[model samples]
Target: MAIALVLVLVVVGSVLFHVLSPWWWTPIASNWSYIDTTLVITFWITGFVFSAVVLFMAYCVYRFRHKEGATAHYEPESRKLESWLTAVTAIGVAAMLAPGLYVWSQFINVPKDATEVEVVAQQWQWSFRLPGKDGKLGTSNVRLVSADNPLGINPDDPNSKDDVVVEAADLHLQIGKPVKMLLRSIDVLHDFYVPEFRAKMDLVPGMVTYFWLTPTRTGTFEVLCAELCGTGHNFMRGTVLVDTEQDYATWLEKQATFAQLSTPAKVGALATPAKDVAKVE
Candidate 1:
């Protein structure tokens, strides 16, 4: 009797705790509220199964208790009971999987108007690149990476000249605009995750991955590396600022383009030396 009461108490306590728990998801800042819905559905299905199983156990303990001189009856498994269990299990599994599949389908189907932004990840830092006036990003190769070109933008590519480069700085996005994020890693594996956006993707060393999101409001959000790249994984952090159209444009204008970054060094190296200038005069 005591065991049955304890089992029943466990189920009650769990349900109460779930209802009263203050630690729930942070307020969603993006347009992925459906993701929250899917999660809640999963929780409901699992919670129901858990409560039912525990309560049933409690019933069995009370009904089939070892009464004085009660003879134990043993019987082979019944096909009818086996069939019911199989059907119920199948339904439960399908209920949990269907929503996830639907969400994934929508998640990857990026909009045509979404702007492309490249996110380059290295150990303990983050960098970003955006298209300039041309509205197109240029090609990049890992082999082209150097001290002067950390992002590996192809110097020979004309399109790369005007590409805006931001290294180890905050990324700014125009609110209400859709953006497709291109992810790449120069070193070990990493993941770009923003909790408010409900979006994340892995950055592989040799290849690029992507995801899309539309900033619904203007605010600053923290970026975190969801993958363990090395000993400094915890220190891999970044900031994303969502701004209005004018604010975003102002920020973009202040960033240095690839051509601008390369031009100063080239001009300095080609400058006439003081001795050469004196002799020429």
Candidate 2:
């Protein structure tokens, strides 16, 4: 009786808690509401299975409780029950995977108009690269990363000369404009995530990963490195500001281009362009 009561309580309590929990996902600020829908479907399916299995166990515990002299009845297996379980499990798995496949398709099919922005990550800091007047991002490599060129833009690539760099600063985006975020890592793995956006992708060394989204509203959102990095993992924080066109244009104008940062005023001294981190706040 006690076991049965606890099982019943567990099911009822979990459902109520989930429904009433104050800690819910932050209000979505981007165009990935479908991701939230997928999560809800997953929760409902898993919750139902959990409740059913626990209730069945409670029934078994009470019904098969030891009696004065009840003889045990052993059945090696039930083929019918096995088939039913197998079919249900397969259906549940399919229900979860089908939505994921759909979401993945939408995620990779970036629109042509989506502006590309590069996000570079290291042990604990994030940087950004945006196309300059040429509207094209330049070639980059890890080997080219240095104190002066933290983003490693290839100097030889003429296209890179005009690429704007926003190192260690808040990324600003024009609201309602689609953006394709290209992810890169200087060292180990890192994941660019913003809870409000519901879109994230990992940055793998020597390779680039990407995802696209359009900010649906104007607001300042928090950025985080979802991957477990080094000892400074917890401090890997950044910001993404979704702004009106005027505000975004104003912010972009203040950033320095690759040529500006790489240009040496004299023989051996590179021009020290002002950093944007201080100005972005």
User: Alpha-carbon error at 101 in model 2, in Å?
Assistant: 0.6
Deviation (Å) of 98 in candidate 2: 0.6
Clashing pairs in 2: none
Could you give candidate 1's per-residue lDDT for residues 1-281 as a string of tens digits?
99999999999999999999887877777778878989999999999999999999999999999989999889888999999999999999999999999998988999999999999999889999999899999999989888778899998888888999999999999999999999999989999999999889999999999999899999999999999999999999999999999999999989999998776443344476766645544
Query: Residue-wise lDDT of candidate 2 within 1-281, one digit each (tens)?
Result: 89888988898899899999896889999999999999999999999999999889889988998899999899999999999999999999999999999999999999999999999999899999999999999999999988877888899999898898999999999999999999999999999999999999999998999999999999999999999999999999999999999999999999988888875542134333445333332
Ten contiguous residues minimizing lDDT sum, candidate 1: 263-272
The whole-model C-alpha lDDT of candidate 2 against the native structure comes to 0.92
Q: Model 2 residue 161 lDDT? A: 85
What TM-score, computed on C-alpha atoms, does each candidate reach? 0.91, 0.93
C-alpha local distance difference test of each model: 0.92, 0.92
Model 2 error, position 5 (Å):
1.5
